[model samples]
Target: MERKRHHEEASSESDDENYVPYVPLKERRKNEILKVTKKLGRAGRLLQEEEKKESTDDGGMQDEEEEIQVGPNANMSLLDQHSELIKKAEAKKESAREKLLKEEERILESVAENKALMGVAELAKGIQYQDPIKTGWTPPRAILAMPKERHQRMRKKMEILVEGEDIPPLCITFKEMKFPHIILKALKKRGIEKPTPIQMQGIPVVLMGRDMIGIAFTGSGKTLVFALPIIMFCLEQEKRLPFVKNEGPYGLIVCPSRELAKQTTEIINFFSRHLVEDGYPALKCLMCIGGMAIKEQLDMIKQGVHIIVATPGRLMDMLEKKMVNLDICRYLCLDEADRMIDMGFEEDVRTIFSYFKGQRQTLLFSATMPKKIQNFARSALVKPVTVNVGRAGAASLNVTQEVEFVKNEARMVYLLECLQKTPPPVLIFAEKKQDVDAIHEYLLLKGVEAAATHGSKDQEERSWAVDQFRKGAKDVLVATDVASKGLDFPDIQHVINYDMPEDIENYVHRIGRTGRSANRGVATTFISKACDESTLLDLKYLLIEAKQKVPPFLAQLEAESEKYLEIGGEVGCSYCGGLGHRITDCPRLEAVQNKAAQNIGRKDYLASNAADW
Candidate 1:
């Protein structure tokens, strides 16, 4: 049995060696093609079966077959039966194809019907699809959406003028202005029942969607005059386009200084916070200024903001980087317009205006209207309602002005004496940055808590000084003209001009800082021979116009004295030629006196020096 098994295994091994294991590539490819063809045929049969089932279920078609009994004399062959089955499968496939084509046509018809319904709905809602490429798209009824009769009423009440046309009177109270209940509540919470003169007139004009140039005194509530209207407009826009996240803000407010920008943003926050509490969408306000980090600002912008309060220089930087775009901006406000022009930001302002090409409501609030500012207004603003609350280029009547005549060498001594008598929280202004620093140092040395702010100081240092002064940590703040405009510090008792400003308009602004928000304050200016004669007459006029006491010396200066007196010419001590020190205080004079005293008994040295001289 073992030999037989061995013989079978040996025969199997010999057979394996004789047989070829690998097939030719051509024959293998042909076999694969045949296998694929059979699979495709089976797939087609399955699809046809599914379609037939669906058709029967729908009661559209039915298939019937009768079974035939095969007797001993049956002549049907297996090959003939297979061919008959194939023909039946082909017929089912054809029926399935026709059904698919019909279903496709039905689907197309349904889609067309849906599109038509949507178009009709849009038309009914009065929603017009504007081409973004052709026209800058702004939401319909985004702002100033009041009815014509109500608008006319509001205009008449506030004496609102549009293109020099007078409308009918409207409501006077905050509630009558049709502000949201929450906004009115916020105003009430702040104990602000009556609007200031500027707000009373400016609000209605802004609400009517008219461009405006508001000339109001400092602390006349001008900030709120523009801020409240802007907040309302932004809220309206937010409601209209809930998902819009523009690259830039919808409302852009440009101020001359960072502090003013920050102040405006705070006001926006104060109003917007109430809106969010009343179930409205939260309005985001960004203060983009030089001292803050640009990256953080960029991040906030990316998250989306409704309003942007920015200074010209920092805003220009962001604009150049393409981080912000004002193409869709609807409202533009230039706060402290005259100050911005005076700071040489005219070109920057123009560049910013060029970026906003669409229809925008512009509001310019300035303390004074200079010729340059007037020209800027003509070019930048539309037919705006000019609201002048008081006389232009005049100081506030709330502040009492006094001029003290002191020698240049005694100015610091006078400042120290003034500080001893006056209350804390004093703002001191100097003409030059060096003088500001020197005064700040001198005050510190004299045991008076003081801080300094100037153009030469870094942004961080300037902000620190302002913050310290605001918090009462520093009683005195010595600053240059940079702080003379649009900075609001509550309860500031006095403003001291340690050195008189060369420009008379600057003197007006310097004193204007103290008497803010109807608070009574005092402005004391120190006059010396070093001051330019040209500004004396203008200064006297300003003081007199504001009902301030003008000194006899200043009132007597001639108007033509400015042309004769060189601005920067020497006008100090004969010996030292230094404005801050007298001939008696000169170091060289002291040294010569000490030498002469030491050589009093040396006759030989005196005779030799005299002969040489």
Candidate 2:
């Protein structure tokens, strides 16, 4: 029995020895099959090659036979060989297809193992808030879409300068001001015999070397108020110094924004054109603003500038670089001072002021002078003439003001309703960056061609937004306070305050956006119960004093809102820490529902019937 057991164990050990480190029998069989298949492929190719050689021989024979007698035998041989070649080519193509499929599968497996999809998920997180359809969805096309005819008509309207019958408060007589005979002749050529209230008051005050503060609404010829005096001063000073080809600027005009600076410079250039008729070359004017090449501006400054119109930031930058010499800047003017503070550029204004030393005549003009500005005036102006042209912070008499109460969540919806109910080309103001973006998206979804401008946007974007709003490319512009000052968009029949402004003066500035140039306009304020409604009362009182009829609906709402605060008292907004509604819930915000309503039927309706070339 022991011998038999030992023999069985020996057989087991032999089996283990045979299996150790050797290829499995099943794998060996698969290798043999692959070898056989490869051999078959080689053989098939060889056979195909032989068939081609035979076909060539048959073709030669057929050509030779054609020279004598036509025969079907060569033709049948050629057909059979061609059929065989096609079969082989198709088989090779299938093999290549299979190889490509395998390679694709391997790549997919590798990607899966690496978890590449995780990276995409991470990327999506950054823009999730702005993904319209997923979050309160609004279509982008709807917001930017516009009716073609409306845009065309709006573009046709020109922003006329100084045209009205109120006998511009500052009309000038030929005797009061001392202009060279040449300037007087040029003024006559343009048919401008008298200056507006602003020009009349501002020109002489600026000329007298006294720091002056002129408060006037836009379209009151404010540009000319500063321009005429500066130009006349420069011209007069230039004539005094003979053989002075390169005299420093006799006047400097600083604006809050680039748009205002450009507009002011254009107005100066327009008035200076008459210099050609005066037997003198064109007046040397330099325009310096951000977004333009600094080197070019430096070169211009080096070449010498007679008059410089610039934004506070760029001008300060140039001054720091020693590119601009302020030693000869005897005359200084700050246009749109209120706007500079609103844009957080108060420090820049202070910096620019630092460059000036004793005996410089500083002229500061604003639509409404806030306390900060008052302090600036106290320090900057030297016992100057303070002329308040219009009622301080009162809406224009021609502007009819209205207020609507809406729920905090429904502001966007109310905005669209107001816009649809009102005329085309309405301007909407939003108080926050996110609110402006949200309103812009809602407007686009409503099928209203609209754009927004804010401090967060770059110069090009801001300018494009403003241009689109002005040219009627976009009928509505949702902007922050940047548009509140020095922005003149003609044909804007309505101005909607999506959020009530915190300050009463800002309310006036907001409404001043419309009812401009003696044209009739409407200013609507959207207020929610959560917002401070006292601004409405302040606005109503101011309008009443201005002789404008107050809308009864707003008056009733204002009376009811008085209960929220003590009589003759002010309640501050806890959210914005300001007196009006929380800045976050600014009355300037339009409701989303309002936006959706405008978007309806917009997708199918073409902006214009005119065929696009």
Winning candidate number (TM-score): 1
* Alpha-carbon deviation at 609 in model 1, angstroms: 53
Q: Which tens-of-lDDT digit does each residue in 351-380 have in candidate 2?
A: 675665334666777776643344444444
Candidate 1 per-residue lDDT, tens place, 1-613, comes to 9999999999999999899788965458557756765788977567656855775785632222112435542456778777877999988866764564455335334322122111233334544322211112222342336576775565456444333344213335666566788988998886678776667667767777767788776767788877887788777777888635545488899998876787788889998888888899888888889977898888888887889999999999998888998877888889988778656786787678667646577788877764334544654455556776665555788988989899999998789888765699999999888899889889988999999999777788988898888889999999998888878887798999998886656777788888887789888999988876545555665666677777889877654322322222322222322222223233434555677677875877889899999
lDDT of each: 0.71, 0.64
The 10-residue segment of model 1 with minimum total lDDT is 130-139
Residue-pair clash count for candidate 2 = 28
**RMSD of each candidate relative to the true structure:** 35.0, 31.5
TM-score of each: 0.64, 0.58
Error of 2 at 202 (Å): 2.8
Tell me model 1's lDDT, rounded to 2 decimals.
0.71
Could you say which candidate leads in lDDT? 1
